[model samples]
Target: MNRLLCLLIGLLCISCTSVAQKEKYKKEKVYTVSKTNAEWKEILTSEQYYILRQAGTERPYSSPLNKIYKSGTFHCAACDSPLYESKYKFDSGTGWPSFDRAVEDAVDKDVDYKLGYARSELLCATCGGHLGHVFNDGPRETTGMRHCINGDALVFKHKESKNE
Candidate 1:
């Protein structure tokens, strides 16, 4: 009986330690240093509001860019900076929009070692907003690159853009 009780105590200690470690690993620090409430709201749409400002992702297949393949540049919703041009885009089976690369001075790539793996994270240079992840697994004829971006983070401007 005493042995059974000791074993139970040991198990409980181990479980508590594991739980604490998991929490430490998954902790996300939110910064309140940048934009104010009205600034963020004024710069973002409802969907962009949830994703870029709140770190949320849109449901797959819902982005109009999934069907968009025209001559235009995709801009950051927050800053109106050119991100991806229509020329580098391709249909990557991962579902979220894919591009071969980003426009110059548009994306800021940081080495992300999240989830115990090495990856490059894409962000808006101007606002430090999360865009998405980039991968090397792409088509043969293509740049062998995949810039899997979040739809809510982008606002597509058609080629010969009338909105300019």
Candidate 2:
């Protein structure tokens, strides 16, 4: 019985070490647009602060950007970093705005175990704001990767027509 107890304690220690390392990495990583929680709250709406700063998700189908099909760029609402082009946007029927791909180097990815499983979490490279997750299931004709993004974490900028 003591041997089994020792093994269990060893497993627990390993798990705790990994969790501490992840927390250390998060605190050490710096973003170009880093700001304090109070400062972020001052600039972002409550929903935006929740989604971007606290990694909270907005309710599905609640974002107007989910249905926007206009020609434009979807930028990080926290830092105005251009992320997804409208050409890559698609209706995944998942309620959130879905994109086939993001603009090159505009976003970063990390593993998320928040839902008790590993998921690819997407973040704004410029600000480290949590945008959403990427999945393997997407249109096969394109990148075959669906970047499921939170519309509340984005700001859509309409592309300018040359007519003006």
Candidate 3:
């Protein structure tokens, strides 16, 4: 009986401490770091700069993926984060680029209700840069998901190409 009382008291104290710690460590959104002009010029192309930094979208049907049928990796232009793979690339006929999945750990999801519909917005995990939105209404047999990405957010890395 003595041991049982001591264990119960110890557990209660631990629980109280945990609750206090949780209350003290409140969560807050940390915005992504802004890049300087020189840093942006060094890392990104002119098109990449307009989209990733200025939140500009590329012209529809202008993406190379509109006709891309090759094998390669797609990476974020701003942060050099590997995003999508060639295997998951599919033609969604959406003008903008599309993917079935992002490279593992490449994307971070958050709530976005931009069009008045609840959506899962994905960002480049490395830089907290916005990538695109994910929807559950995609084709079956897969994840039933579509990662509708902005063409401006990514730069293609073709397997045969020597460009880094």
Best by TM-score: 2
Off by over 4 Å in 3: 1-38, 41-47, 161-164
Give the per-residue Cα lDDT of candidate 3 at 15: 100
Inter-residue clash pairs, candidate 1: 71-159, 72-159
Best by lDDT: 2
Q: State the TM-score for model 3.
A: 0.68
lDDT of every predicted structure (CA atoms): 0.81, 0.94, 0.78
Q: Candidate 1 at 139: error in angstroms?
A: 2.4
For each candidate, how many residue pairs have backbone atoms clashing (under 3 Å)? Answer: 2, 0, 0
**In candidate 3, how many clashes are counted?**
0
Where model 1 places Cα greater than 4 Å from the true spot, the runs are 1-34, 111-118, 161-164
| lDDT per residue (tens digit) for residues 1-164 in model 1 | 99999999999999999978986897453432368757888867888877776656688888888778888888888777888998888988777989998888777777665558867888887776778888889766868889998888998997675654
Spell out the clash pairs found in candidate 2: none
Encode model 3's per-residue lDDT on 1-164: one tens digit a residue.
Answer: 99999999999999999978976896744546456768876787787777765555678788776566578888887877789988887788778778888899888887765678777888888776677788876668787889988887887888875653
- For model 2, the local distance difference test gives 0.94
TM-score of each: 0.70, 0.88, 0.68
- 30-146 per-residue lDDT for model 2 (tens digits): 789999999999999999999999899999999999999888999999999999999999999999999999999999998888999999999999999999999999999988999
Query: Mind sharing the TM-score for model 2?
Result: 0.88
Higher-TM-score candidate of 2 and 3: 2
